[model samples]
Target: MTNISGALVSLALVIGIGIWGYKLLVRDVSGIPVVRAASGEMRVRPEEPGGELARHQGLSVNAVAAEGVAAKPADRLILAPKPLDLTEDDHVTPAAMVATAQQDQAAPAPVDQTEIAEALETGNVEELVAQLTAGVAPIAETEAEVEKVVATVAETVAAEVSAAERQVAALLDAPGVRHSVRPRIRPAIPAEVTQAALTAETPQSVEVDPASLPAGTRLAQLGAFDSPEVARQQWDQLMTRFDAYLADKKRIVQEARSGGRTFYRLRAMGFEDIADARRFCSALVAENQDCIPVVTR
Candidate 1:
């Protein structure tokens, strides 16, 4: 009976120790300052701003990091740009700007629009040409007189040509004349020469002397003068200018009249034949000197 009581006492002590050990391990575990894990590390409940407990509760570290990235320069929020201050005291008006621009630019020279307007209004070709060339004004009476003289010269030339043709016909009919003889043919005059003869002389007032030219002379006519004296003077000038061509050659101032208007032709005489005279005239033309072949008979 003693032994049995001793065993029961021992069992009660063991039960008491087990109950105390369970209470110390579970109920008072929060009271412990630190708990060592298998790796000898102290287990801790993280209480940082972005802790595991906070992350699991929806405030994650990734979300906070994303917010930080947005705060950087790439995603920095910018304030609205300010509008232009148009009404400042230093601002310029459109009128003032235009006036300033005008002051900076140079004014153009004034033109004589009256001359152009007059040229357009009158429609007189000679007057317009005179104005353009700044030459002497043309006289209507002088032009009419010149035209009459030209007509007379043309008639005289026609008469001479007809006389020549008649002479040729007469020669062909003569018993003494050779049946096989070919008549001399005149060369065609160039348009340049015809145009020059029509309107090349410069207007000059001078006295005239009427005298006939030497017959059967093949000459080159350079120009016509108002007076025989002027023609002689022009010949002297031309001789001095073209001494090589005029050397050993004779010059004559021949008189011609038509419609009571006298004209003195300046002629270079002493060509061998009509062909020679025409060739010399061509040479003169090449030298910018106007000349026309003339047959005196």
Candidate 2:
């Protein structure tokens, strides 16, 4: 019976201890405030010292309650360490200095925008030309170089003339069929007739071929020459003057008789039409040259 009473006392003590623990743990301690850090961790308010270590942390007690969370009036503040000041001991390498110098050298100098704007407004082309040719050398043909070139050209011409003379001498010395060839015979016209031909000023009417008198039959008459030599000289002058127009064109110096007077007529032949002949004459007349387009009969 004594053993049963001891067992009952032990059971009652255990029940009383469990009830006290439930009251302490399960009961709401609404008065006690809890702090929350920025990290979302719950911490005891600085005023509530749960341990000796918490009280020694020298935390402030005055706090503001915000949304059921205690906020510290002044929490423990931390600051980053200040950077050390530079000294002569901080050395820069030679390569780094060289690279910096190169970068500075490679960078273009600052331009004065105001000066540029003023120059542009004033139309200062001389300044622009000076800038463009600042470092460029002028290209000039020196007098000595020109003289040397002329000398070279003269020597070449002399050599060619010498060669031509030697060739002509050789041909004259050579026995050939040309040496035995006779000169062409000229028509025997009376001196009076020739004089009249030379003085003739009027245009002559001449008969032409029917085939040559097609729809576009026109002749470009230059002049009536007294002699073939004079006609040839005039023809050469015309060839030089109208080289482009006369390319592949026929030049003729024909002897025509009118009223017992014979004269050599210089003409540019084979014109396709009167329009073409007129055009050639118009161009010549524009250049102060006299030319006539004769309609073929």
Candidate 3:
């Protein structure tokens, strides 16, 4: 009897769903353009063409010009403000926080060097020490408590180590613990570079002064390589590829080391300051090349 009742309920649900779906799919409002289009009663309005169609539309758009009623260009400008004759040469890019321009700077971190010095000069060791150590009070000098503290720390460490040893032994004796040890890891060899690079003495990196170069001069680094020869080769290839932009630039190779491996950086000099160098890098980047603007003092 329960199964028959459930079947009746399911049949009623199916009938209700069919009726709702029929109304949703078949019933439509006449106001909607999509419904009107489906009934083949909608009209497609063509866009107004400014050419021959304008004449056929019963109005000559150029009737004033056809009747020789056109005004002079100067007469039109008489009512409007005179425009300035600007060229590409008049445009200039702003230096947006590139380290060299000294633009868009945040507040600097505060220091108390003078205050600390004054305290030290006045022989106020306590105040100086407190400031230097971030308010950590010094141990009292009246009693010999260092030995006692050391002894307590040593005893606590010994107890902890003994407990750790016992736990480690228990873990080692368990069936899941492996007795064998893996070999120690060795350092992998560095990447191989050009033959000349082996004997070539790498130049030490030194900070260059911005004023050291002629006025309106900046430097740019193009790539980093495993050796000086590779860096030089990259510079040569770049000169050939981007001769139009880099014709006046001089080649520079800088040496740097990291993790016991030496690297040489390829650079170009003779840009019209850091901005010019950045602009040059932007052009190179647009062509899928990597570039970095070198900062100087």
lDDT of 2 at 296: 56
| Candidate 2: tens digits of C-alpha lDDT, residues 1-34 | 8999999999999999999987887666644767
- Model 3, range 48-115, lDDT digits (tens) per residue? 54444433432334444454333223323336678998797687633321124323434434547897
User: Candidate 3: misplaced stretches above 4 Å?
Assistant: 1-217
Report the candidate with higher TM-score, 1 versus 2. Answer: 1
Q: Model 2 compared with the native: what TM-score?
A: 0.27
* 1 versus 3: better TM-score goes to: 3
Q: In angstroms, give how far residue 246 of model 2 lies from its true place.
A: 1.4
Task: Write candidate 1's Cα lDDT for 118-162 as tens digits.
Answer: 777887557655555453334785588568766776776788789
RMSD of candidates 1 onward, in order: 55.8, 47.1, 35.9
| Candidate order (TM-score) | 3, 1, 2
- Which has the greatest TM-score? 3
